[model samples]
Target: MKRFHVHVSVENLDKSVQFYSTLFGQAPSVVKADYAKWMLDDPRINFAISRRGETVGVDHLGLQVDSEEELLDLRSRLEVADIGFRVESQIGCCYARSNKHWTTDPAGVAWETYHTLGSIPTFHAREEKTSTAACCASDSGQAGTFNTRRETTRAKHCC
Candidate 1:
């Protein structure tokens, strides 16, 4: 089954984790030093949060598919719906080898639908710099300017 995923940026990771755990009536499935994620079965949501300065809202929203075929199917459906998407493959952002379809909603919130192919390699400044440049080139027309701060934060924390 597909899961609706939401990643939020929070000022305090511990506080947010406690609040969300209470709200969801369960603890998170994954927790790192600066991040937490809950794989909620009842609502089928993959909710994640990262501690990043003072930001306290959605970083991005997305759908997580089970396979590459499902990801392609979603891309096809988006095309049929007359929606434009920016696609990326094997891009090392948010700590994974994700094939993602990026787009903005009517309200202008960025959305990413992705299937993570594998974990990203260890942190390498040159490699990350290259990936960031490539991702910008890919999404320039679709998302306008990529928020470098947020992208860098994701690279450091979420990965």
Candidate 2:
């Protein structure tokens, strides 16, 4: 099975969470000091919001899968299209670890297809403090930087 994923950066975490909670008619499934996620089964969507000093709007869109086979299927599609994409193996972010691949749509919107492996304590693990340019492969979405964090631009300067 697969779930639609949408990540948005907001101005206020609490306020946004409250608004979304009310709109969704339920509280978030996972709430962090700076982030909140709603794993909605009704629509099968992984909707998440974060307050990381970034612009307030839809950040990136994705498809979250359940198994490696499903992920491979998505990858094959991207390969068939000959659309360049970046693959992050076991990348840790958004309170979970996933094997994700990123590609941009015709309009420059990022589309991340991934299979979640497990949960992690931190939103994203820090390792040797690499530059933001090295995090994601590509996707020149609205503001570039692939929405990794608001402080940084976005998804590592698109492919």
Candidate 3:
């Protein structure tokens, strides 16, 4: 099975966490200084929030699969849909190790399909000291108007 994922960027992490916890009727499963996550099973959504300096709104949407096979299945469907997509192998982020496939909806909303393998100590858990440049290596313009070679702006979200 796969769970829906939503990452939202907020100005106040503490307030946002409190709001979400009350709204969800439960506390976040993981809470960091700058990030918090609620692994809710009732709605099966991997909801996360961060204190990144992005627009205070929905950051990105995603589908979190339980295994590589499920992740590949989603990837295959995206390929068959003829939409441009990019895959990052074992690119760790969000305090977990995950392989991700990224694409943008027609409305310029970014979508990620990933299978998180395990937890990591750092938010950007990659081999070597991951430069902000390498962590968000989106292919071409499929991932919206970001990750261009000239623009080394790191993703505003926690991941």
Against the reference, the lDDT scores of all candidates come to 0.66, 0.71, 0.74
Ranking by TM-score: 3, 2, 1
Evaluation by lDDT, superior candidate among 2 and 3: 3
Off by over 4 Å in 3: 126-135, 138-154, 157-159
Per-candidate TM-scores read: 0.72, 0.81, 0.83
Expressed as tens digits, the lDDT of each residue in 16-36 for candidate 2 is 999999999999999998789
The top-ranked prediction according to lDDT is 3
> Distance (Å) between predicted and true CA of 3, model 1?
0.4
**Candidate 1 minimal-lDDT segment of 10 residues:** 132-141
Per-residue lDDT over 1-159 for candidate 3, one digit per residue giving the tens place of the 0 to 100 score? 999999998889999998999999999999987679999999999999876545779877889999999998998898777766667777667788788877677776777888988888866655355243224454323432332322333354334
Tens digits of per-residue lDDT, candidate 1, 1-159, equal 689998888888899999999999999977776567898988999888876323568767889888999998998887777776667666554445677777666666667788877754432212543232222123323333344443443332222
Model 3, residue 48: displacement in angstroms? 0.2
Q: Rank the candidates by lDDT, best first.
A: 3, 2, 1
